[model samples]
Target: KKEKVDFIVLLTQSEPELNIEILEKYPEINAVLAEEKSEKYNFVTYVGEKPIVSPQGNMGSIVKIDIFKNKDGKIKQSLEFLPVDSSVPSDKEMLKLEEFYKEKLDRDLGTVIAKNNVKLDSGFGENHHARYEESNIGNLIADAYKNHFNTEIAFMNGGGIRANIESGDFRLRDAISILPFSNKVGAFKYSGKTIVEALEHGVSSVDKKAGRFLQVAGMEYSYNPKDEVGSRVSNVTVNNKPIELETIYTVALPLYIKNGGDGFQMLKNTVGTVEIDSEKNIDSDIFIDYVKKIKVLNPKLEGRIVVK
Candidate 1:
């Protein structure tokens, strides 16, 4: 014993394979809490003998586990997940704050920034989220990054897109809600070899619909899903030209990737990185500014990413 502890729970931001590896190595871990979304497991799921629980997406579900000691002193766990809808009462204080936010946005002078003529979706569906694939919303954000920074290429990971805006007015609040993170958009002078490494790493876990799946601007790339992870990416063209392995290209990205977030360790060795101030270059701010500058939005899929 672990000081009167009968069970162990692991909270992780890792993928399913890593989580499974952890459980395999540490038998004491009885439960795993992750951000992975699944349509079937709106409740609970079993991996081997342990149960994996998730909050799903859109903040609409929660898991409840009941632990009990049997007459023989063996521990047992029962898992159940419930949907969190309007039926559940909200905390008055929290509800008040939410209402205040809504009212403030509604009355704000800069609330409406632009008008979107067509729906821009990131492939995050209600029953199934195909967020890893290239999407029009992803391309739009990627375009914003590339254009704002004046770089040869830019990338917007699909997972970063949180919500889809139906065709209509694009508001400041809508930009914030769609790309909610405070991560700053920045750029680096990276060798073509490093770019290849980053792309390989990005699609390494595509089967899991990982957040690393990159949606790109100024580039068209293809991959073989049946190939091994390190060799999957190929036929990459930047700005209508084949990538030159010796060329140093200026690439724009969210600081999360440049700083080695989401397993992009290859970037740690990059040079001439021009990072913008976080407060001035936050993703939501960039998005709002870009939409306002464009004044109109027309998002579409242009075959930037092909899966063979």
Candidate 2:
């Protein structure tokens, strides 16, 4: 019965063109079903006259293909999309899923962690501004690493902060949502010159919303956005003392940045690189612990990053 079918559908997340070529080897396969590269809904394209049906991820929609045989013995195909409405009432299976998720993820982890609201000033949660200037939430997150690792200076990439939290009860879910990545905390001994170079790279692409912006703790610096990229940062200091070019300062940051993620190549070449508290410590867990310890969390921008 399978051999008698007129259409062959291949479901995959790989490149569409490669899948089409593989399907062509089988002459019996007239039409191939595959997902769109862009994951756009209701998208249909032809690869060498073969109909390819692509569906969006997360079951965003159901793709329906209708094939018709013309009177002249030719075949024609059309597509339809059935979007998934999450607001619809749950079925029996969905109710079971709700129960499963609640048992696993919906437990009270802790009481209110902050007395005041923690602001997330990422240019209204936009990318470009977060990496360029000081943000309350950014400062808080960077402080977490600094405190946990007991480093002289710590900073995190602006892109690592995923969301903002209002003044209210803090939960494990909140921390998870904010620091979604599983980046481990890392520390290294770096010179003031290297620190300056890293900060220079951080602000190099501020106009493009690049993710390399450094949100720091235990140190502060002033920079002119209008200045040339490598020469923007100045007045850098660690512990209120001006950064000495010959001094090797201990810095704490995510392993992602330490390994040159987000263009932090200078960090990877630090004097003595070390992973703090083992690589098992996750970013979200550290942030959660910091909030729990501080209780009344209030992080403010105090010219840690002076942007003129």
Candidate 3:
């Protein structure tokens, strides 16, 4: 009670008022309870900043958790995340990530090829070429899955393409360095409700710097990043038609998004999901190889992702 009272006093703006019940019971807490209630509440409010909810502002940054049991037996976790912002240089973080990737690349040529940059001959122009090429790559991947494995839509992350290939030449290692994080493409079967929740989460997380980038092979959705959570997504279509919320939809997303990365915690809680591991699976690698062989790959907005 002494520590609690001290903490309360330290946090509040006004003096806390005390009820005499504790003094009546034990007679020892009267002095500790002399503070006014208003002060205590004000102090408590200032102890921690309010949680950020809007996409335009800084939502809570990524945090790592380390857990331990307190003396009172309540389990508490300390935030162990590094502080970072847009001002931080990418190279500072690049080397740390590259070292781990180099070790992995040593073992797998497929992974290495997918990460590298291969500048194809300039029969195709840049804008039309890249967008069409990426879409074609997406289509080929989707087609490959459809023909062999039972798959519906294939989705890729636009950010996965680290750099543009020049007409002359480029290194695969350069591409890998650009998109360093080891995220695999993932496919999942989900209920319409689950899909809605996932889209809502994804759209609401887009910041101005980090564009609401998502590549879809099937289905289209438009959402406003400025809108409140759960209200962002609108004009969703599947198979060239409006999406029916009651029907199940098979959608493809990066493995990170499926596992609750990028503020999509709803993905973890949603029920009845079948996630295809992109790393172990041959379908995704074959798709990438097919793209490389074609010498063209690019993705453009097909009215699937948007802002108000």
The parts of candidate 3 lying over 4 Å away from their true place are: 1-150, 156-171, 208-213, 269-279, 282-287, 298-300
Error of 1 at 294 (Å): 1.1
TM-score of 1: 0.86
**What lDDT score is found at residue 147 in candidate 1?**
76
Q: Which of candidates 1 and 3 is the stronger one according to lDDT? A: 1
Q: Candidate 1: where is the Cα deviation over 4 Å?
A: 1-7, 39-43, 47-49, 67-76, 92-94, 126-132, 275-279
Over 1-308, each residue of candidate 1 has an lDDT whose tens digit, in order, gives 45978888899877777877888888888899887465334635577769877775666788888988889988888887777888899999999999998788678834789999988887564511334467888888999888778889998877778777789888777787778877788888999999989988888988778888888999998888789989999999998899998899999898888888888999776778755544457887777778889999998889888888
Pairs of residues at least 3 apart in sequence or in different chains that clash in candidate 1: none
What lDDT tens digits, residue by residue, belong to model 3 across residues 136-212?
A: 33333444343233455555444343333443332354334333455565456777777777666545544522222
Candidate 3 yields a Cα-based lDDT of 0.45
Best-fitting candidate, scored by TM-score? 1
**Weakest 10 consecutive residues, lDDT, candidate 2?**
119-128
Report every candidate's CA lDDT.
Answer: 0.81, 0.76, 0.45
